[model samples]
Target chain A: MAVLLLADVNDGALATDAVAKALSAVKGLGEVHILVAGTSAAAAAEAAKLDGAAKVLHADDAAYDHGMAEATAALIVSLAGGYSHIAAAATAFSKNVLPRAAALLDVMVISDVTAVVDADTFERPIYAGNAIQTVKSSDAKKVLTVRTASFNAAATSGSAAVEKVSATADASLSKWVEDKVAASDRPELTSAGIVVSGGRGVGSQSDFALIEKLADKLGAAVGASRAAVDSGYAPNDWQVGQTGKVVAPTLYVAVGISGAIQHLAGMKDSKVIVAINKDEEAPIFQVADYGLVADLFNAVPEMIEKL
Target chain B: MKVLVPVKRVIDYNVKVRVKADGSGVDLANVKMSMNPFDEIAVEEAIRLKEKGIATEVVVVSIGVKQAQETLRTALAMGADRAILIEATADVHTDIEPLAVAKLLAGVVKEEAPGLVLCGKQAIDNDMNATGQMLSALLGWSQATFASELAIEGDTAKVTREVDGGLQTIAVKMPAIVTVDLRLNEPRYASLPNIMKAKAKPLAAKTPADYGVDVAPRLSVVKTVEPAGRKAGVKVGSIDELIAKLKDEAGVI
Candidate 1:
């Protein structure tokens, strides 16, 4: 019952936190093996080893450069025959690739899993993290995508033997011509422990500066509602909703957000929710642990000053 | 140049979903369903391309139950020339996988041979973000995922993609697939005239077998449960108290 972790290379190696959580979820069942695919196989190997992987399988090829989701999925399925469970971070690549592989293998794929009760059962969120569901796979093979922030990233450090594996490239499949990664110095929202989000109440892009300051003070990642992002007050990457990244932070501070259902789907998993809005009847307050009814213009600056 | 657009009907973005008490899946009873917001962007992009003379015709397709046609009608109302609904019985989010949909879409592409294929970056329900890429792979065509800007010139299409770091511009030859990002374009609402026109538009119903694809549940739902409830925390009377709690207790500051 080996748990195989598919390490996607682009987001700076396997999502370490997700890998660690997946490993810890099934630590006692069997050995953990990580399959690293990308142009930088060595970096993947090193990262996988740090996550308590017993062995690292490296597949380095030019075709793996842009991380084409289809090719990667095909390769994983090809290699997944022997493993009982296949896991990967619920990133863009895994979200796109793994389900197809599971279908090809004629097995069940469990996605966005936050916990694993045993080798065969898993726990995950539904309805945008507003609800949790436990699932048990009846099939022989189980494919899963782990939400990186749900559990603490494994910190077991040990050098693992790296073995080179040849992954057949599918020329018939479309290749990624290029990738334009959004450059950011801040922590990735999905993995951040604390997140500060702005909503339609921000009024303008310049007002986001206040949210940014509050985030900086709290050392938190910045997020936005679909309304804010669509209104062009923030970049799409900052958007948090059904359409954006799903986050499970220890604390999520929503500023001036009206808390649409779509927006709740993204950050509702936070352990503690703090909502600051002028609208006393905003739906966000329904889910908030701490609700503040005040003008953001005065509240944000005051909050920053207090911090 | 004919353009192909794929749309999906999902739980309306505005409706709150409840997990079934039986732990089977989400409770969809009386839940409002709508065309995926991202797919709307794709349909909007394809329509805009046709309006701008880059595309000669626009065809919309969806994979779901018969009710999905309502979503197709919405797309048609927005200006798609025709619509095709590939009916399937599996749950759209938890059961049917993206690869299967891609295979089905690939068959449609072969029959239609559209010069360009446009889809949303990902459907909000599953948020898989795979169909477009998988379709491109199955068709052996170039792909531009998360495209914010797109332009067609001659036999090639220039696309500006939004990634994690910044914008990247890439040029792929015609007969390529492009996934529309949220920033791609603001989708237009269907006007009264277009709504009336949509009623007269051509819409065809088909099955997964029609595309020669097996629609099966690659994923199984173990159970559906509620997330952990958050306990209410102390509400500070002043900003200073809030900061003190955050710094001393939460240690977030």
Candidate 2:
């Protein structure tokens, strides 16, 4: 049996971190085949080789330029018949496309998987990252989405052979008219090693300056809860929850968060969780490795000062 | 222009769900249920549009059991013109997938032919977040997921979406599906007068067959289990001990 990694082209590559982690997680089980779907299949093939993929399946088409989820899902479903299991990074496109394909194929999809126990068994977070659950898929074909932050990006090898294959696109489906990519030079939240999140307790968007300061000090990315984003304390890009980006970082510092389960679903997989809240009994402390019971007004500034 | 808003009834956000011993599903015995918080935002946005004269009528739709009508009523009380409840006795809480629900909504859209469709970006319960996009795909209509801002032009709608990297602005033709994000708008509380008006408002009830959609579970739950409990660590009184523990035990330093 072979493990097929569905490479998302929107990120311009296999999301190297997700590939490395998935490859590392299932090292001894099966040969890893990285499938690249894009206009430039050769670029994706070269990138996949850097992640230690044994073989690269390149599906190049002009219709793929916009990264339409429907067309992408259709392609994956058609090609999925060959592999025992399919995996992709839990990015926005993967989150929207893969499950629909799995449902179309009448198979089970295990999402945001952090570990692979066996061919069919895996470990993933259920309630945000507060609780980890072990799952076993009984279906003949299994689909899984991996959290890129959980594993390291595969080191680049010198080169690999690429095989080009032409695939059909469903033009009848709706196409992406335009992509408004976020303009940011900072590390992407899903791939960041350190994340600093704020909550409604921050008061206003101006208060995010302090969070940004500390994040800059640690070279970390900034995140926010649904409460903070809804309250207009921060931008939606900074939001973290079941509806937002699912992230795993080495160090996650949550400031002024009450730790709602929905919010926890996004960042619970971090290696070290530190929560700072005036309310000592906040649910965030339940999962935090280091808890600071104080007003964020005082603690955040002091953290910036100390760092 | 008629506005269509789809709402879902889910466990109250404040309620802590417990998995059943048999792993069949979450134990919902006597647990309080409420309209999904994001759906409330969608309903609010539609009502605001109607009030602003951007829309002439607002129709609320929900797909679930009879209990879901309570949620539709909540929407009606908040100023929706009418309510339609698609009745299903099955455990929608378990078998409910986004695509199945979207297929049902597509059928309703065919009959209603509303000019605008709005839904929450995701329901707090399962967090599938695919119905709006799936509906858009099935209908071949334009879509704006995770919408934070929306404005209507002559024949198109401009939406600003909240994506992982940042904000994205997309323009889609009329009769598009727009999913509400958290920051979209603040939902208004139901006034006493509106609450009274909702009691007299018409609520039509139907079944899955009425819409000609299959509500089968495309994805089955192999099992539902509680997360592993984290071990409690000792609290140190001094920063030095904290530093020592961090370096020796946690290994961060």
Candidate 3:
């Protein structure tokens, strides 16, 4: 009974934390075989040697060039017979692709599994991580997506064999289009060890750069509240809340962010939370392990200097 | 073009869900229910397309118990032309998987033959984010998920998707599936006259079995537990104190 883990990759390299973390979660299942399905998967295949994986199956084709869910699902469904279980990181790609694969197999998918209770049972969060539920799959084949933030990334020390595979068939229903990604030098928000987030209190888009400077010094990712994103002070991807990306990094620094319940839903799981706001009554202070009642403008620069 | 939108009845977002003491599931007795917020967005988008003369008709569908008829009426009041209630018995053990739901919707799609299908990316309750993608797979239709903006031409639909980092723009031919994001548009409230008129609108009811799909869940809940809560913290007197706690105690820095 081998397990197949779908590696999330971008620009030819694999997601450093998501694949390994998903690999770590499924380590006890059996010999983990990885699937790198993409157009240019050579670099990702070379870097997919996480310690938990025994083999990396590489499937490269133009049909998968767009990362369309339909084609990817078809490719996985064709290979599903060899593995007892299939899994991937609960990222955008997995969210799009895994369900189609699961549906093709005529089974329910155990989404965003935080822990492996056994080969067929798993733990996942419901109601936006407010409640955890232990669910058992009755299907013959179990398909899963792992929450990247809940587990630690496995070490990249294994010498896994990389075997190139062919695309099963033509399942192209969508076409590739342009991707307008935000150019950022800082770490990606979801996998970053430390995240410094700003909110409406940051005032303007230009002033929001103050949070970036502090994050740069700490090598942290820059995040934004929904208010900041709605106000056009930051990109939509920067927003962290129930409606946005949920992150559980090691250290989360909230700068000028008043913690709404929705916002707290996303980052409350952080190991160490630090809130910086002039309003002592800010909701963020309630969850912060260390709360400082100070103006972000004056405090942030001082903290940058201290670092 | 005709637009078909699939909606869901979920616990009102304002109501705080409480886990059952016996580890069964979230208690919903006497709780207020409303249309899923994302589904409302989808309905709103479809209505806007109709108002703009781009869509000739808009049909709404919901799958749940008899109470879900109220949700379909709500969608009709919100400007859907017609409604279809695909019934499924509401019980702890009777829940529809995304695949089953998709298959049921595929039945509706085959009968309706709509040129465009607009649905929410995911219901807030389950947050599976699978129906639209799964349905598209079943129908062999082009799909655009997390659509923040959409504009339809004669045969092509241009969509702007809210991706992880930023946005991506894509073009798909007609008869495509679009799963709306929150940024698409704010759903308008049904006025008194419209609500009254919705009472008289034609609402047809059917069952999942009628569509040849079984709604029994493929996964069973073994247990449920409230997430660990974070305790109230203290205010740091100085930056030095904050740094000390982060480095010495938290060891995150």
Best by DockQ: 3
lDDT score, residue B164, model 2? 54
Off by over 4 Å in 1: A11-15, A25-30, A99-109, A117-121, A130-141, A167-185, B20-23, B90-100, B153-155, B165-174, B231-234, B248-252
User: What would you estimate as the lDDT of candidate 1?
Assistant: 0.77
lDDT of 2: 0.75
Q: Candidate 3: give the clashing pairs.
A: none
Residue B66 miss distance in model 2 (angstroms): 1.2
Regions of model 3 farther than 4 Å from truth: A168-172, B92-94
Worst 10 residues of 2 chain B by lDDT: B231-240
Please give the TM-score that candidate 2 achieves against the real structure: 0.86
lDDT of 3 by residue, A1-307 (tens): 9998887766566776888899999989988989887766564555456887888888877667556777788889988898889999888778878887887888777888889989999998877776789999889999999987888889987778888887865654566578888888889999998999999999999999899999999999988898888888988888897778889988999998998866887899898899999999998998998999999888988899898
Kindly give the stretch of ten consecutive residues in candidate 1 chain A with the minimal lDDT sum.
A171-180
Error of 2 at B184 (Å): 1.7
What tens digits encode model 1's per-residue C-alpha lDDT throughout A1-307? 7877887666445556656665666555577788787768556666656656888887777666666655677788778867888887776666656766675665656777778888788887655666677767776888888876666667857778887788887744353446557666777787788999999999999989999999888889999998999888998878887667778798899999998877987887787788888888888888887778788898889998776
Candidate 2 residues B160-218, lDDT tens each?
77665666566677788888987788899999988888989999999989978777764
For each candidate, what is the lDDT?
0.77, 0.75, 0.85
DockQ per candidate, 2 decimals: 0.35, 0.27, 0.68
**Model 3 TM:** 0.95
Q: What is the lDDT of residue B86 in candidate 1?
A: 88
